[model samples]
Target: MSTATITPKGPGTLRGARLPKWSPYAIAAGSIALAVGIGLAGGLHSRVQWGLIAAILYVVGTYAIATAVEGKRQAKDRIATSLVWVAFLLAVIPLASLVWSTVARGLKVLDVYFLTHSMGVVADTEPGGGIYHAILGTLEQVGLATVIAAPIGVLTAIYLVEYGRGRLSQAITFFVDVMTGIPSIVAGLFILSLMLMFDMQPFGFAGSLALAILMMPVVVRSTEEMLKLVPNELREASLALGVPKWRTILKVVLPTSIGGITTGIMLSIARITGETAPVLLLVWGNAFINANPFEGAQASLPLYIYQQYANSAGSGAAYDRAWAASLTLIAFVMLLNLVARGIARWKAPKTGR
Candidate 1:
């Protein structure tokens, strides 16, 4: 008599038949290959369309194969997983492409000299021009806005979290809410209206005013949230030690949340630094460096990029300058983020070693 060996199945604790580990990878590869074939055959141009096609094929192929081998439930789970991955790629690819394109085009004109010089006498179509003036204006305007907004925002947050009560507090909160939702254009228009009434001219400080209006709500919201996260035990301990309420808040509460507060302020600064509308409406884009922001029209990086692109008229030089300006602006924002991260790390509450 001939005996046959038995192959044991998976544990009973593990329910349902499962597809092989390599099955999804195989399906994805096949889907990509098929999508490429279809794209070439159908003469489709957009790579985005190809990616979508590949994503669809991958999902469909996974479901069909999984259902055939395992079951409907497993197939549904796999489809969901595939879809999430596809969604992530869809979001990330565009951003990656933008960075790549900007770097590629910006390198042609970006240099130390390009950064240090100004476009004072150079025409828009000229090959040699720099964003020094724009850079200076951005610094002054954003710095001034921060100076105007940060203190008020921090104080308001403190009041809301600590001393606020009843109708007055509610009204302040309500107004802050309304201000937070107000558009940059609306802030610009408000300042513009004031300027129109007083016959004021476009100046960097005017842009700073509009930017301050936009920055305040963000700073307030962020600071309020940070203050709320500070443990009440700290406050109680400070108060129990015969410390005055104001002293306790100043010494204990502020220090504890300083990291987050600083981070939020930096992020707010970053947000306003990129704003073009308010600057365009108020500062009016100057090509020459105006060291005095209070008197005359000023240039900013966003406005510089916009001006270059709009006047490019398909000229390669202008396009390159625009890309370089964009790269510089991105770098500035990235630097702010790095600084915020550094501050957060340095100021974070020390835990048990």
Candidate 2:
């Protein structure tokens, strides 16, 4: 008698075969045919809707049928994976479209003169006007707003996160939420009224104040959340080392949370930087360069875009300037983000400490 040797198959060999790549194509073709049929029956508006219905039905029906053929668990996993990828693509499409549109329109008039010259010489028909004054004004106003807002916002956030525990905290939270919901126009109006009461005409500084009001609540909320994430152990450790409460908060809690607070400040800056209504109500500059924010009028990037686009001349050189100004504003925001990231990286404490 001879002995025979047996070879056992591996576990991977026991797995079910994958569906053919042609399966999705076939499903899509069938879906399109169904969509066309429904569209013809329903006419124009319904026709458009039918295509969406058909696509959704095809995806769901195909998944169900596949699951029935292949086991429940595997089919569910595969379908869920497909849907997730589809959702991601759907989101990216609109974001890509928006960036493309902004870039295309903005590139039309972004030039040296557009950056150097103010709107002084550039007429509705003329094309060589620059946004230098607007750029300067925007920086001044936004900087002043940051100066006014950051201290108040950070302190309020610290109070809420560190010391707030009573009904007063709850009241403050409610009011901050309410302020966050207040429209930019309303803030503008409030600032305008306050100025009028003071018998002072609206100026660039007033616009900064309005923007500060709009920005402060946002900063407070974001910073409060960030500060709340600081470990209580850090505070305890500092206090055990004979540190006073204020010193513990300043040295231990704040240093750890500084990165996040800075990020929130940058975000708030971005939020108020594009506010048109507040600047419009407070600042009134026609074309001249006004460096002074307190006594003189000033123009900002957002106001420049508005003034240009709202002109009697619909699509002219002035409109091109508006587009260019928009691009500059976007560039400014990008720079601020970079600076914030740098600060965060530099100030971040060592990990695993």
Stretches > 4 Å off in candidate 2: 1-58, 61-69
Give the best candidate by lDDT.
1
Candidate 1 TM-score versus the reference: 0.91
What C-alpha lDDT do the candidate models reach, one value each?
0.92, 0.82
List, residue by residue over 275-305, the lDDT tens digit for candidate 1: 9999999999998999899998999999999
What's model 1's lDDT at 38?
96
- Listed in order, each prediction's TM-score against the native is 0.91, 0.84
Candidate 2 — what's its lDDT? 0.82
Cα error, residue 228 of model 1, in Å, equals 1.6
| Lowest lDDT block of 10, candidate 2 | 1-10
Task: Write the residue-wise lDDT of candidate 2 on 72-121 in tens digits.
Answer: 77678767865775577458867887667777888998978678878776
Best by TM-score: 1
